[model samples]
Target chain A: MKTLDCLGRRCPVPVIELAKALPNLEVGDLIEVLSDDPASANDIPAWCRMRGQGFEGGSAPSYLVRRLS
Target chain B: MSYGQSVPPTTNLDSASGLPLHPAAREALLTAVDEGWADPSRLYASARRARQLLDGSRAAVASVLGARPEEITFTSSGTSALYEGVRGLASARARVGRHVVHSAVEHSAVLHAVASLDTSVVGVQRSGAVVASEFAAAVREDTAFGCLLAASHEVGTLQPVADVAERVGSVPLLVDACQLVGRAAVPAGWSVLAASARKWGGPTGVGVLAVRTGVRFAPGWPEDEHQHGRWPGPPPLPLLLASAVALEAAVMESAQEDVRLRGLVDRIRAAVATIPDVEVVGDPVSRLPHLVTFSCLYVDGESLVRALDAEGFEVSSGSSCTSSSLEPSHVLVAMGVLSHGNIRVSLSRTTTADDVDRFLGVLPGIVADLRAQAGV
Candidate 1:
């Protein structure tokens, strides 16, 4: 599990942080992002889909995802 | 003549709010209703009472803008405030220079003013933010002023105002904070700042212009005596009171609302991304909390907006601002991005979670419907 803390952050901050962190993850690795912005709930999942990765689950203030092969 | 009336939906999922007016703000407006009619500048006793309300309002607005009371002047609208500020700077600094520099993605008001200026404009990347170094390179020794917005109104991409200030060096920096003030704090070192009360929470027809002391300008060209003759005539006291109250309300709730709205905008980007042939515009990470924008390929933005409106959504498109001319959004066009079917969702402090969920629920379906109808 690789973690990127983006709590209290807004758009593109969480998005940018995740983009930077994505490369470090191996196949099937987990990337967790903590954020309070409502958009992150949808943004991370969409980002994962765009990159062909898997987004697991998250509540407001916390988001978790898995990187896929 | 016999057709039945079709009313619009009260819940605007496409808007930043479920309700047009936030409860607290509405209450504030009501509790202080009496002050709404008083004239702050007149010599009558009632005017004195109005003056108290006006002073407090000015102080409240000044607090959010990070400027002194003497520096702040109220205007009728955001567009007018920006025009006046840009023009004032251009006129005041003409002795020192005749050239002006502004980001390519500036608001229409700024762009129009720039068009009116005898100066050059520096274009920006598709991200809608000017390259700071490139902007600095564009400035000449005879540069009269430099103008930069706190953020792009259409795309919601934030500009590095402080960095731009540094780039301006000795030149005056006219900062358009219309989309930024009350949501994000103004960056320090601006020579002049402008904003609209409506963009935050105040009523329309109230704009703010804050000029730092000692900046000289030609006041007679389009002079108003309102703000030290920089603007003319007596100010609108009721609207100013409303503006101040709205500013205070926004300041109080901004942190929490920003968090909520950011999430909402992010969700919008995510949900919209699921649809085929959709491209979300702007810097994904570096945007305002309460705004998000996107475009659909090969679709007309006006039609998309009308479709959304028909589906109980009250949203706007950057395309509509250019509706009459049928030109694409300058913000999107400047970014060299797609301009078709562009829509901008801007939130108010009154926005709700349910409201966003409703929008997310309706948006993809609306897009799908439009796509099907367009046969794309």
Candidate 2:
């Protein structure tokens, strides 16, 4: 499990954060993202889909997802 | 005048139409035409049925705009409603005072209407906001009415309505809620409100105008008994229903969608900021969640918008689209910011993180290409 802090970051930063975290871990690893920008709620899920990963929903202030090979 | 229908051969990022219906509005439009095409202003049973649909739409729109059903009058477009609203207010408030005060950042509709009136437009700071204190200081005791947008359409900056209203003393506030209605909750204090249905995922040709309970509105036309004779036009039942449905849908889904759009905007902001010579306009925290605008120095905005369009992205530009005119956007110019190579990206409920990523992935290359071509 790799936890990345993307809080208070705007567009492309959260995506960049996920991209950096993904290459370091094995397949099926859980990654957590904390964001304050409202758009990230939708952007992250869409990012996961584009990357061929799965997004489990999260409560506000945080989001959880898993990497798939 | 006939509206032309030509489809561009690329992905559209235009927030004006919102993300191309996503099955709900598209499906609704197909059936709504069949079920709601009857003339709503007639006296027959079928007309009464159409009237019911119109009434339902009114209630729904009123609910979202924070006004009563009796106060709302539907018009063909937001421009028409604003023309009517300003004209009506000018007539009604003329006795009190003939002067109208508006923000420097208003839409062309509002600005055009004010141009025809005895009006004064208050300017903004470098941050794209019309200061409440400056606006109040500009108003005289003889000033009758005022108008301002809750959020600007071009730069996406919000106005200080409640504070401005407090400073204005007793003048009525007309809020152009076109950009902010569905995206955020409106602050209480406006006496009149207007918004375009298309801005929030509804069909075009439908606009909502809400006049507060106590404000006086004298219709400009010699009219009969429709919409209190305030606006004199036949209402489109199908479009109204579609507008109502879309507004309600936005309200239901806004909390989640807003958060999502803000995130994408933030990401774009961060990426764009890292590039030197890029100036991102608008207030970073106090603006709309789904919209962000940036102006690149030493580049033509139209060329940038066109380049992005060619690359499968549909975005809007502050650059004048009319032919042979080289005037920059009044919004950017007023804020004393860069005027060329400016683009405004807005998101809708249908927009996904993938769309933002695709936009981000393609945008840097497009800007770099345009810069290389311009020899910047």
Candidate 3:
């Protein structure tokens, strides 16, 4: 399990951090994202769909995901 | 026409926001201020002359839009037109039910108009085109009004308005043509239609609403003789005259302009796809002739717009960071696509090939540099 805190950052920033951190994680590893930006709520899940990663459900300011690709 | 800006000439790639006033419109606007200064609704000689000019303007706009003169009502703006069209249609159908149906990709004006009503929003696909079958299934017996855009205001994706109109039988549909008027063929079968004049190189603060002759629309505003009893107070004569002239002129030239601009937008779409980590949004084929939107990963939309503006190109963004409301663009959110670093470049009627060539030459480097700065 890994945690990425992007509490104060705006969108694309939180999503960018998520993308950057995801590469280092092995397949099936869990990455929990903490983003306060409103766009991040939907953008993180959208990023997962576009990037071919698994998006496990979680709410705003906190989304849980696992690396699939 | 110059406003005394320091720069020579900045390329305006934000025409979706509004095009520069049409040449015909500018001429009409200057002449109208002096010629149409009197109160048009009065019986006096000067007022009578103003009344004739107003009627002529309405007739001109009607001929261009394929509607009757009596059917057209000029509102304060495109948003106002949408409000009037939406509220009026819904009011008349109050006996039916409170339910309304609209596409998820519809402009915010439509969304806000139906906020209080029982609404069912039909979602769109990745290309921003609404699923036709899904839209048809949403229309129910109690549905009072069905709202759909002729084309998307943001992504430029052309909607299957004709199909949806056919499917939503007996449910009066209000078509918002704010994005495609004077640029594309209007899909028929709308009981009511609304559009903004600035969209077709007309002045701001002028909008058009055309209700079909037999459509059962109850005026939602207070009782007033102005604007065919649809709105209150005297109309803005000069602005409306200019808007009509611009719409007429643009429609006359639309076919030729569409082909030329479509070629330019294609060049933009193809070139934009070459940029690394960039996903060009919207339907490539069934889109507006002059607009293209693309998103770059690991980049901020506002920062990208600033960089583009600094490079002598003005563009717009739909990302949440670009809006004062801080909410992501509902259009993008509905499409379920990446909302990162989006740039919407729309070409005006005056945009030359050289302008596009210049933009293409610099866009890649800008995106690459921004990505590097973010260390992505």
How high is each candidate's interface RMSD, in Å? 13.0, 13.9, 1.1
Q: Candidate 1 versus the native: TM-score? A: 0.78
lDDT of 2 by residue, B69-182 (tens): 998998877888888888778888888888888988898899888786778889987678998999888787777788888898887888998899888877888888888877
lDDT at B20, model 3: 85
The residue-by-residue lDDT of candidate 1 on B153-270, one tens digit each, is 7888988888878867878888888888777767886898888877776777778988888876555334544567767777777667767877787788888888888988888889
- Give the residue spans of candidate 2 off by over 4 A: A1-69, B1-9, B17-22, B37-48, B320-324
- Each prediction's TM-score against the native? 0.78, 0.78, 0.94
Better of 1 and 2 by TM-score: 2
A best-first ranking of the candidates according to their DockQ comes to 3, 1, 2
What is the Cα-based lDDT of residue B305 in candidate 2?
A: 79
Interface quality of candidate 1 as DockQ: 0.02
Preferred candidate (DockQ higher): 1 or 2: 1
Higher-ranked by lDDT: 1 or 3: 3
For model 2, give the RMSD to the true fold.
15.3
The predicted structure with the larger DockQ, 1 or 3, is 3
Q: Evaluate every candidate with DockQ and list the scores.
A: 0.02, 0.01, 0.74
